[model samples]
Target: MPKKLYNIDFYKFIESLDLHSFTVTDVTRYLFETYSKEFDNKKNATQFVYRHLKRLSKEGIISAIQGKSGKAIVFRWCTESSEDSELVHRTEIYGNKTNDLIVSQLQEKIRRYKTEMLMSVGETEAYSEWVQEMPDFAEYVKPHYQNTREQAKLMLGKVKGFERLLAEHEARLS
Candidate 1:
């Protein structure tokens, strides 16, 4: 027998938390701790959890019960007899929208980073070329050239990381 394939679903995770009320902070901590593989860091985990919380509230699956107290907004799941089907429908719709938003944002970041990367490339070239053509200033320009090259390397890593995430998200959608 072969094992079945499975992917972690954020909506399902939220639904599994059978709590009467919960705050975004609480959920974020739990999510970040439990799904360390899915998220790169706590900040990303918090953002993902927050996005779903807002969507769930908008869909009436959850309602805000706090925040008027000047504290974290707590949410309560609205349980009803028809919740299963309705929950599935609402989450499915909102989930796709959320995913689409994430994809678009990632694309924008990739574009911005690529632009910066190109600028860094030009700076790196200019600095290195200046060092050879103007040997008297090489001592001062060498450090700048090395710094620009290092920055370009870091930006390339970030671009690759974003591309990997984009691919994973697209694959999940299909």
Candidate 2:
């Protein structure tokens, strides 16, 4: 059976926001713990996040609820349109343009293909060539796991290097 890919972006957007009104301290904690969706800065907190949250209010995703004494702003999730669901009867607010399901699927496919390629190509040199392509391959793959698929098709569009390497390994073993 095939695995179902979930739409995480709608949830991600909700996760990114401050559900309740927050002061400087609460905002800091929210940014640090829950959402890495970029609150102006991931590492530092200052007027940047506060300012941006204010801007978000203008976009209708958040509303600045002014109480009697303390000014507390509660941000609401805009569930308007099929973007969130078919149940939205309100105005559109702060949903992103596209969901992250596609990006996640693409990455998963790439990973599965790479694993298959490694099993098929049976030589260190061929594997090494493939692993050397990604800009962040070193960080992504473990230290012991070294394989890549960048040294691509020949002028004839065949994976000649990989085939040659695999054959060389076979011949040596024989």
lDDT of 2 by residue, 1-174 (tens): 553332234324444563545444456565555544544354444354456567656655555665555665444444431344522322322222222343444445555555555554444444455568764665555343433223221211233444454456446545
Instruction: Please provide, for model 1 over 1-174, each residue's C-alpha lDDT reduced to its tens digit, 9 standing for 90 to 100.
Output: 553222657667877776678899989988888888877678778877787899878877778876777878998877641557776867888798999899999999899888888899999999888878899998899889889888888888889999999999999889
What is the Å distance of residue 63 in model 2 from its true position?
0.9
- What local lDDT score does residue 156 receive in model 1, on the 0 to 100 scale? 89
Against the correct fold, how does model 1 do in TM-score?
0.50
Each prediction's TM-score versus the true structure: 0.50, 0.29
Off by over 4 Å in 2: 1-24, 33-44, 71-74, 78-174
lDDT of each: 0.82, 0.46
What lDDT is reached at residue 94 by model 1?
79
| Residue 170 lDDT in candidate 1 | 96
> Could you tell me which residue pairs clash in candidate 2?
130-148, 130-149, 131-147, 131-148
